[model samples]
Target: MFSPKLLLISAIAVALVGSILAISSLYANAQNDEEKAVNSRGMGYYQTTGDVLDPAGSSGSASTGIEPMKYLRTFNYGRVSTLPNGTTLREFTMIADDRQTMEISPGVHYNVWTFNGTIPGPTIRATEGDLIRIHLINNGTHPHSMHFHGIHRAEMDGVFETINPGGQFIYEFYAEPYGLHLYHCHVQPLEEHISHGLYGVYIVDPKTPRPDADEMVMMMNGYDTDSDGENNFYTVNGVPFYYMHHPIEIEKGRLVRVYLVNILEFDQINNFHLHGNLYHLYRTGTDMEPDDYTDMVTMSQGERAILEFTYQYPGQYMFHAHKTEFAEKGWTGMFLVKE
Candidate 1:
């Protein structure tokens, strides 16, 4: 007379418990036949498994270890000043390096190429019509270059600006068409460079400037662990499920502006969704007008937009990609609106 559904669930639970115990006991029965730690061969490099071949946990060659929370509000404003002709000049420096390990998830790691030693690099911000000067140093064994997504002269284009290892280049251009843009290594084998993590957000504020608000940058990206064409894990700000563990704290009833960018390689499109609110979507942030008032937005690789919203009540809300496969894999987060 017991309910059939209840009995089925009970049986499944018991079977699951038994399987877990069996798997645990297998390790206990495992005996070491032969094991040896291979050392030497004069390889002074890091691997994707978070191992520094030179010295164990050496601070000199250690990874940046940038946590998601710390990188959330980080922005690079550069040295700002006014030119004699009444224009803003922003000077910035970036170093390109390779053979750095970063954990994309718990116990999961990858060897990442970096700009200033972070996956998504630094958020470079400037005002419209400003003279943006970037000094790029190539410290990696491979040549690298920065191709910015904004209006600039042909000579300043990155394709021909590739810098050999131990070299440097100066790229100066005017920030035109105020919007949320992006930059990445444009060396040959472009996809390989970008997939290895040499990209960042570029923000050029409007001349009039947008309203005051809590602004944040979210760059949608992914990590391919197996050298396959498909991505194994996706992330926001370079860490999977980071916001879910440390929900973004925001004040209730405050305007929140998000400069969202989609730089996910191996995927045609990516998206964002909110659980309990809608936002005004500014496609590419080129104009002040909004193109849509919705809770979700889909963007292609290199596509970016600006979204503004306000949380009414204080609580925790989930935000993630509308694509179920992505959310289940890693493209998910939470926002905590505190009273």
Candidate 2:
């Protein structure tokens, strides 16, 4: 036996619990449907439901099979030499050549131009305020130059100082702006030079280091296999569909920092999208503050940004160009998060 007031309160509580459970079931169903839709789109390209391991395929003379950690994470600090005055100098030797054949994708080969015998060249890293030098050697028939995207003196600029066949030149400059940058061949028919794969990443680290994390770099590029002036195959770090099979492994709770660049020729714009989470984006990797907190970021040629994020749940996540064609054409990958 209960008082009339007590009975009313008990009835109300039961109805509230029933309503809450009903809402939860609906929400869970919605999540499942969304996931299924995403997987449906991936159908034959990639699968997020299985274990991802090192992919089995034909990589070229230089392969970014696993991307950044090997090709990019292995930074060339240059030959560090100290002066009599105790000043440290970083020096590099860059060679320009072309018509070298490389399998940009499985069963697809192209005549790639290179710096230091590799497409996208070497990842050059230096501290802000340091003096850096590049000794350029032109070993090919065509003239080539190293144009860096940073502040430097007029002569050090690689545009007018093109090196003819068998010739050499030196570019010396002070690293500044403490951000991500790039170097490329900037001769006449600039688009052709870049499209031919004559570029690499240049990084100037801030004096005060940012928070430590698992860091990596990505350079989005494309190849015109049939000379149609449009890209037939797109890639990250010179290989097609590399990371899709060999997912980037990371700890579940640690921060991941990515330095991403878009050097795709012909295409007006490209974009990067992360699945299951959003990230803080520092546009151009220049500012200390974030430009936006987003799941996708778009860029024009030579544009880059710094992305920082952490995953909460452990599983596989996909990353790709939000534009369907690019991802299907090979600009795609995955991240395996684990405890």
Candidate 3:
């Protein structure tokens, strides 16, 4: 027979152990909820699929015999009109999404304001001297206008004084200078406009023949959004991680060129890295002298870089920012090589 006091002591010890276990279980559950919330808050749900085409290989020609086009004509933007090639140029409306109140990425939900409900808007490619007529259709309450970076024409500068709600404006300018460039909202409260996500990349291929490889374009930007509170958002081509476009494809031992442009409101120093290839940066800005070249290049705000490289191996490789923070926030992409 146990003493009454001993029995009471044993009961108290058991109760204490049970309480500890229950508390631990509750804590773990709470932690899991927090993790899920964090993930849900970072989703920017968007996706697309298309076959990657090698500009070099598609146009059959030998390396030495390859001849670049002398001059390319620009495609005029119109109200959903068809091009001579049967391609269509249509009017687009960009709307803003609150990053603070919406769920975006996979397993993450956060508020973000985006153009046309998408980050980075759309990629606009045109030939030299093409008239680009973009009608600024402001769907959000905020006033917005777009400025073409590196474009010297005054009418296309997207002056705030020239914009109105639901008002349309035509930017008719020739793409005289060629290289990588950008266009973004330039209305007052510029910082707020950019932070809300209204920007994209523009590429003007040279009239001459390019290398015998693949071509890719990337636009880097940063944002700050309120989600339950304010949070920082950054991305390459409007998406973080591997969400935007999967690994970019290339042929083994073929040359590749990437046109990189940064249109962030703030000055950024972006360090680009390829997983298993060495790149030669050959040109910068709209004023690319005929045959200028450099192994590595750095571009400032409103600047561009043309990077050329050859893949020696066949696999999927990551190309991303050396800035770890950007990489975590989605400033990364993949480079793929096929045997």
In the range 1-339, model 3's lDDT, one tens digit per residue, is 799999999999999999999988887733322121111224532222333222112111222110111101112233555569754444444443333333233333444445555555555666555545565556555666777765667767887444555555656565547777777788767766666667766666566646555666666666554422222545555445532244556788877767777665453666666677667665554554433343334555566677777878798888777777766666666666799
lDDT of 2 at 325: 83
lDDT of 2 at 188: 81
Which runs of model 2 end up more than 4 angstroms from their true locations? 1-69, 84-86
Better candidate number, 1 or 3, judged by lDDT: 1
Better of 2 and 3 by lDDT: 2
> What total of clashing residue pairs does each candidate reach?
0, 0, 25
lDDT (0 to 1) per candidate: 0.86, 0.82, 0.56
Q: Per-residue lDDT tens digits of candidate 1, residues 1-339?
A: 699999999999999999999999989845654443434336443223333332211221233265667667778889999999998899999999987887666666788999999888999999899999999999999999999999999978888978999999999999988999999999978888998899999999998989999999999998888988998888888877677767899999999999999999898499999989999999999989999999999999999999999999999999999998787677888899999
Which residue pairs in model 2 clash with each other? none
What lDDT does candidate 2 reach at residue 212? 98
> How do the candidates rank by TM-score, highest first?
1, 2, 3
Q: Give the Cα error of residue 257 in candidate 1, in Å.
A: 0.3
The alpha-carbon deviation from the true structure for residue 122 of candidate 3, after best TM-score superposition, in angstroms, is: 1.3
